[model samples]
Target: MILFKKKPWKLVTITSTLIFIIFVVLVMASIIIQISNYKFDKSQAKRNEYIISTSLLNSGLSFEVAKGDINGIESIINDYLSYKEIHAIEVRKLTREVIYRKQKTINKELRIVAKTYSLLSQYDEISIDGLDKVENKEVKTIAKVVITFSSNYMNKKITQQALFTGGLLFIAVMITIFFLYLFNRYIYKYLNNIINTMNSIKQGDNITLKNKGIYRVEELNAIYRSLQELSETIYKRDAQLKDSLNQAMEAKILAQEAEQFKEDFIRAISHDIKTPVGVIINLISMIVEQSDTIKDNPSLSEKVNACYESSIVLKEIMTELFNFEEFEQQKLIENKTKVNLNEIFSQIKSLYETKFSEKGLGFSVYKGSQQTTQLLYYINIDKGKLLLVLENLLDNALKFTESGAISITWIVKKDSLLIQIKDSGIGIPEDKYKVIFNKHIQLNNISTSTHQGRGLGLFYVKRIIDLLGAEITLSSKVDIGSVFKINIPITSTMSTNTENTLLLTEELSKSNFKALIIDDDQHTCFTLTEMLNKYGIETASENIPEIGLSQMTKESFDLAFIDFHMPNLSGDVIMKKLTSTLPKNTTFYVCITAESSPYHLEKLDTLFHEVLEKPFDITDLQAVLQKALKSKRVTNEVINNIKGKS
Candidate 1:
């Protein structure tokens, strides 16, 4: 029944149909033979009856009738009628008078008769004693014998035989058909299972032949075994592939972690080196700043200036190394804020002015025209990136320019700000303009004398300008000069209000502003203390953080300088402690560190009121002092306001 619901297989359907048709044909032929035998039996029965009557006439019944012996004829008829097939018998005279008659009460409708006439003439046997000769002559009819036989029984027997044979044939045909159906269904089941298993394998299913010996056919069983082997192979291969993939993933994770550790180590070492380098540069600059004492000794002054310049160069080399690492690591993230272009330009000018002077080159920064200056040069920008760009360009200009001037000129327009750094240096060839900005490219024709460059300054500048979404262009003529112009798109602008500059006066110096310095390095503390003492400000220094925190608790210093990296406690932890314990806005906390990475600076910015990068010269010191004094003044004014309101 379940097999019937499925679509029939073409081979099975066609073969079964042919077998059924053949069976039907055979059954029909058998029926035809039975029917023919029945007809033949009926005809044979009639012929046999005729032969029996003729035999009785020849066996003296005819003579008996000729002699008028009716009893003898009756006896012969009676003897024949004893047969079941014979129903009646009779003898009649030549004049048609019944001589002897015997009949049984049989169904007349089913009876058939055979009649024979007996001759009255006798045969003559002639004489030559040993040889008898019979003479044949035509004899007239004297008596007739008729025999009736019932055909009903013969017909019934023939019919029963035919029915029995046909019944057996029919049963044989049905059994043949049933077995054929079962054979077809068995083959169909195995073939269907094979097809389903193949399809499962094609779909990437993990198929197994559960009943391996179920397929009786040798070929089908062979195919099943092969499929089982293939499935097992695929399962093993997949497992191996999965294990390899997992191992590869683990190795990749370890590689990334190692790379991270490498970068961290490099950053840490670079920062550590920068602090001491900064101190040396600053201390040398301070010594050089005392021009009066050194002016008398030309040789000593020359040596001192040379040392300062060499230290400055060393510092620059370290800076370039750090910048290279940063670029390689792609650590520059854009952090835009409102910045005054004027102040940024002023700082760059101040930073490079002395260096340009020492190299006998005129340096100046022009903040556009008077009208442009009054209109505020404030705009939204990434200040650190812009500083890097301007500083790198200026450094390049200073390196190449021997005698003439280097100037930075900027002007604020309606939608954009245009900055141009012009230098009277050996100009670049027009063909080399684009390639000059490529990494590790330098002009071999131009002599850079004692100023060695790593050829990455312009590359850094171009990358930073691209990051800022600003466009930079270069125009140059050979040996005439080169001018780099930067056009920055400004989305918004703001104006700055004028504020009274904090003047360092004798009265302010005498104002007993005690400062606290917390640092693990005694050299840094001593330098800072000396600088503050010169300003008439009393200062105390602590080499340990715990001692520093205790000192802060005992005294309420107006200003504090904290070193960022200490052994016992880090600068941020100290700041956090101070913020939690100390009064709000009491001490103006300044964070001093050599770490210039953006992440560390950003974190320090949140904790400290001001972050002062290490190797501070007199100017950086003065700036911190001025900002601290301004903050203290604001705090005092706020307190006075609160008292007045109360």
Candidate 2:
């Protein structure tokens, strides 16, 4: 409404007023010139006719006198009158000496009379028409005839003059208007287009023009040139601004990537350092335990164990930090396959029985009513990695929980398997429940239980859950308990199962088994061989898979420990070659370099019977060796566990 009340209406008014003024000026000037010319033509025609009539009458009289028609002057006049060319003629004897007068009469009373008849003499006429000199001189020869030549010529002259003058005036006006129209079309419209383009620029739209031809106007053409330059400048500036914005955005993304990389690097280093330190502390504790067995040393044992426990706590913290870092980096791998949570839970329960019994904590498992022995487990996950996450959670729960029940439940939600682990430990602070799954974070309010950890169990659990694209939530109250719920999407496919179960075919328990160990690192091979020798397995080292394979072919070895990553060949190749040569009854253990790769274990199942992750403890290695020793007499359940799903 405001715009309508503003410049548009004003512009319309000015343009219309200018057109009206030009039209009126042109038309009025044309009319005035035509009227003046009409009046002038009438007056000029009357004067011309008067002079011609007076001259003709005087010349006729002079011709009669020169021919000596003194007495017959009237007769000569009458004879000319018969031609009807001279309107009337009169010859009078004036001063008794044949002075002649010729009068061309008009309207019988008004005449153009000439008194001097000589051929070279001048004649004059007055407005009072009677001849004064001939009136007193006599009527010796007098004949007067009248002819009038009035034909409205003055009116006709005025009409023709008006038409000619008006036509010329109209032509002048038309030419002026045509040039004016051309000026508006070429000059005015060009200027207006420039003005409109400027307005569009001010409003931030692309500027362009339709140039029909070069403008005749100097000012308008100059403005057109200037506008083109301005448009180019504006376009270039806009492009530069867009480029600057893009650069800033790219810089921002690069900075964020660098920051995330730094966090992940720190986390990985911390985890790497902590694992070895934990191993050293646990080894020292084991040594102290052995020394205590030979002598009474409770204080020393407790001190050494406490040191070992501290190292375990540090290891947990570092592991959780690493998991969080990987989660943030989106680098955590999810090796999804169906898993039997019941089978997993059963093992956990059995492992925790001794610990729970010592702590006076009741632990039990209630199998669900589902009739499927295989449990129809369809979970997408890395089974070993997930189990580690659950192991940490359960370990923390059991440690904190003295004289209270720890339970594991598997309930079905829509299209999901919801696993719940609840404990009756000194519960978490309600406010801290949300933060409990973060690395290095601990609950300050739980002061009753003598549990120790780096507060990383739940964090690793959350990371594993996230990697699986699952959901986990925590609920707790002070002095009551905490419940952790995990939901994983389930399908109908069977999961790959890999568990070591073995039976001895012969009674050769006391026989010393020779073992060959191959690893790139000398310290790793020596340490592993020394630990195995104490377990009654005599061991040797090749330090590389190729040499180990060459040595194994030459020597009749009972078993081979091949590192998954070696200088000469990968453990998979060694396992493949060994299984091709050795009998199916023979056992091979493939040692892994890192715990992150579950596919390696699945691959190992194709050749070897057992696969151990690096930095395995003495007890874990002892269990693997025992299983290998009893491989020939394994039960169906044991075989099924060892042979992963194809």
Candidate 3:
């Protein structure tokens, strides 16, 4: 098939030539058989009719002569001239010496013949005793009759049939020849030329074949038509290939530009993360050093805590980017489980209730019928992803609605569960509803407030929903309200277990721990250090891992966060150094690379005891840390719990 597309004319020529030869042979054979059969049938039928008529006439003559009805015979013979039934007539007289025969005194006579025979059985005795045995011993007379009749109807039919058949055969042969010639000329010749042209084209010759006239044979005509169609198809396919190649080249250029942009942006943002964090850490250190001076002022501690919270939020945002990137690229292992919606919703409501009150936005959930509320309250879902989806939606509602109430209603249809989040606020335009879930295409009206998000929240919500294969609908009226209907299936049991591993990890974070940070980016190190400090852990850095072996020798750290990329040494290389230098029992290794390429992750998996992707979230970091820490403890229950939760 591909070859045909590549060189259609060549295939057409070969196929059409074979078909033409077969058609010519079939047509000639049919014509010859029909003509020969027609001639044979006509001649045989005429001869049989003539013999039958002669036999019937001879029988009539013998019947009359045996009766010795001479007058009757004479009358019958005379009557034959005027008898329209007699096709032909002849009369004969027999005597001792000779016999006489004539065809009814007609000037133009048809061919007729007669003969007589004597009875030689009566010998000379019978001839002498003729007076006694046979008084009138006359010589026995016999007659042979032959007559020819012009079968005007039969002959005419035969002649007409022969002429018609011959004419038809000749016409058919001529037509077949003409068509065959046409097929070879217009179709096969042109197709072969086009095939050669196509072959040349494939070999980098771009000459186009000119169009030829129609074919003389139908089969060849079809081939020619297909060739034309094929030519067009090839032209179109070539154009498409060229376009695709150009697009691929353009995408390559764009990717390079994007990579450069990301590099520059990360450098600049790294400074942003480190500068404030460094200042706050220094201030905290100074405050702790001069604790006696501000012992009475309690607001200072509060101020310190506020600064700490801001820094943590910043770090969290960055870490979330890392987690989301992994999730988007399908790198993160999804710890899915059947989530009780009612229980989770209750927790979210309690957590956000104070905030909703502070903002004076009415937030309520109406407990409808058991069937309706059951769908919304109980669903088997990925609790973490579901939380994110709800958080994004509620955040949008609260951000947009100032005075109006926000209500969440549940509708249980026959096939699906629908949870509608209605907010009385500046509604989204109908046109924007479809694009609102898209990254960076937030609703126009909602963008008026200072609560402008990173534009990834809704995108994340949509991603999570899609991962679960759920349906969502958004309806709104401008300045009135907006309703988002999320329909999740009731039978979505991603996993059979219901244990919350996140809470377990939160409990494990109470212990004091030591961690090693190996990253080229200073911001990543500082940000992660701050977040980890909140969980009572200390972080040390080894930028570029220049003295990785030296550092591990000096400090016996509990965990190592190694970035995959460095100036010369890679994260896996640093890990190898740590494993060789550190104690034989040390298995605290995590790879945190921002390369985002698939190869990096595959390589990371083979080297690290545990892999933590960059832009680490405190929750994820704590979880990975706990898992790594628990590896040393080797608790079967914890392992089972983690497996069950997952």
Best by TM-score: 1
The reply for model 3, stretches above 4 Å from the true place, is 1-114, 117-332, 335-391, 404-456, 465-544, 553-565, 580-583, 590-606, 610-646
TM per model? 0.60, 0.48, 0.48
How many steric clashes between backbone atoms does each model show? 0, 5, 4
Candidate 2 lDDT over 1-646, as tens digits, reads 1124433533223345468668768776767876776666556545644544454354355445546566666665555554332444444333334354444443543323232332323334323322432232322322222333332444565677677767876776787688568656756766677778888776656676554453333455557778877887886787787799899899989998988688656634543563365356546645764675534767766676667656655654555655555565566665444455655676678656656777888777554454255543444456656676677778878867766888877755457777788888878776776788887777675433555566667777777777677888888776687788888776544433333122221232355577888876666666676666565667899766677888887786666777666555877777777767765434456554444333434666666667665445654465566566655345435767878663
lDDT of 1 by residue, 461-561 (tens): 98888877889999999889999999988765655444212346343475668899999988888878877876778899999999998888878898899
Residue 79 alpha-carbon offset, candidate 1, angstroms: 48
Decide which is better by TM-score, 1 or 3.
1
Clashes of 3: 4
Alpha-carbon lDDT, every model: 0.76, 0.60, 0.60
Screening candidate 1 with a backbone cut-off below 3 angstroms (N, C-alpha, C), the clashing residue pairs are none
Deviation of model 1 at 452, angstroms: 8.6
lDDT of each residue in 18-79, candidate 3, tens digit only: 67668767866866785677567557656655444433343345545556566665566554
Q: Model 2: clashing residue pairs?
A: 62-117, 336-381, 337-381, 503-630, 504-630
Q: What is the number of residue pairs that collide in model 1? A: 0
Sliding window of 10 residues with minimal summed lDDT for model 1: 1-10
Task: For candidate 2, give the lDDT of residue 44.
Answer: 57
